[model samples]
Target: MSTETVIPKVEKKHLENPTGGSKMEKVPGKPFMEIHDEINDEGQGNFPLILDDSVETQTQEDVKPKRMRKLTSGGQEMYEKEVEKYTAELIHYRKNLYILINSYYSGELETLEVRLMPDRINKELSKYQQISEKFIGFLKRYRTAESAREEATQKIIFKSIVSKAKTILNEIEIKLKQAQLAKSFATGRKFKPPSASSMLIKQRAKMDAAKTNLRFASKEAEPERLQFKLEEEELKTKAELLKKKVEAKLQMELLKSEKEVAIAETEFNAVREELEMEGSRSSGKSMASVVDPRQHIERYLQKQQEIMKSVYINPQQMQPPELNVHAAPFEPKSEDIRQTNYEINNVSVANELSKFLLKKESIDVSFYEI
Candidate 1:
């Protein structure tokens, strides 16, 4: 006991022993290490080392950020609600805009209305374009990470809406050119009434030759002043008849142009509504791709014509004189003609032409736009 001090061979962990006392046990699963040194005899020594198993390497999947997922049911419903709201209002505004435009084209609107029509049409088209852009943006935000099928569907809807909008503008251009062409044809064919002086040239010559007969008893005894008055009255009567004919002819052309424009408008609305309906189809099945809008429009129009043949006026079948222009609210009546004449007389032709040129330039610009 006085001189014995034993050294321990290894460090150890404590474990429960049988006699309720602690005992020393070597740690389990410890890595075995080996080292050899032959410094005098060996050329080199090698030792392999390893890190703890706790460190791990990550896979590619875990290293990058994830894409967004499809929207939830509630989010989809919300999207649908917003889209319908915008499209419905856009259609309503567009209809009103077309109505105003039709009025302007047919010369039924007041001078103020004519002046304001383009601004209002632009405002509505601007609104429509904005709504469509918003719809596209919203669709992208919610479905950016969508599967291929949904992505394709969204793209089709996007293209259809964009195409329909551009087509509407084109339709407007076509109608304007059509109306202008008709106006030119009418103007060229209109009758020119003779002036009072020109109408009385023969009478004046006869009167000069009959100076000798004035002294003799003759049927040519009417005075020069009364003869002049008679000729003037005859000329006035003929001029009124010619002017009335011109007015009626113009009214007829206006009617024809308006009918065609109304048909075009109907076609446009049909295409738009078809696109909207296709866009709103349920997601369970694959969405239908956009059909040809012209086909849809034609079928719709044809069906309407067949079903309501009595009320329907065939622009092709009827002559302009029989067009019943007064029945159409947008078409001009006599009062409307008078109003337009007043506007034209008061407003310079050059000013009106300049306005038209500005509008045409804008339309040309829009054609080049996406």
Candidate 2:
């Protein structure tokens, strides 16, 4: 058989060299190099035949011509449409993926079990949901009538959608790999029931841990409980001591007040008794000699009336015999009685003056004058 030369149908993007000429455009799929390597591996050195197969399978129409059009030439509308279409596709894919994950978790997808740890899977799912929501939000924002007409804004939106789509694709691939691994593991391993020794060991470990916790709690809490009790007792004792001190102080103050009252009463009584004795001694001496001046005048009037009667009866006896009025023997002379009365009054006044004098000599001199 004649050997046929085969040529690979490369896209314009792929044809451009990265370093030699213009920058190579990044395609939104597997890299050309990787695809070629896979094909080479599958073909087993039959590169010419594989290249022919790839050329026949891929179509030139797969490249978007609308993407090459300028934004000024109605390209914005075409891009918007494409974005909408892609957004729908992504939504469908997200829904399917969610259903698939749910089925796997529920054991309905037995053939595609997930080997990822539960927490990791949950974290990944959350990230995927967040990204999906962000993507949808971006699409909705760009789809507004105002933003949809903006070519520059549309371009940015397209790039964002593509990046998000790539991220979602990567997450899906990871999930698929994990599922495959889980399935393989399930198939390769045989289930075996746990032995009685293992169950006993686990129960014994749990019992030991509980006992250790109990011991630790008792050891840690006992001193604190005792310390609390001691503190409470100390507080109570201090309160009692303070109460006793206050009571004793109050009792001492009461006793002191009582003693002061007793001393004051004794001093007042002594002063009163001294005043009464002075009054009693002066009262008797002053009262005895003191006579009413009115009674003396009445006696003189009676004597004058008797002399007038005698003159009328014996006119010849012009020189009436001198009338003799004899006084009581016990009565003292008027001058002497008056002097005694003055002395008694002075003595009473001197006794009170002596009490007010500060010096003993002054008190004695006042008493001697009396």
lDDT of 2 by residue, 9-69 (tens): 5464545432233323334442232122222211211111101113332222322222322
Roughly what TM-score does model 2 have, to 2 decimal places? 0.34
1-370: candidate 1 lDDT, tens digit per residue: 1121221232344333322233434324332111223211111112211112222333323322256566778976886677667556655554554455445445576545544555666677677667656655665566433322333333443353344444445555665667679978999889588789887997888897788667663545557668999999999999999999999987776676666556555655554554454335422222145365345345545755776887888788877565675674676588677655543432343233344445545544544441
Best by lDDT: 1
TM-score of each candidate? 0.24, 0.34
Q: Give candidate 1 misplaced runs (Cα > 4 Å).
A: 1-66, 70-123, 143-155, 189-370
lDDT of each: 0.50, 0.48
* Backbone clash total, candidate 1: 0
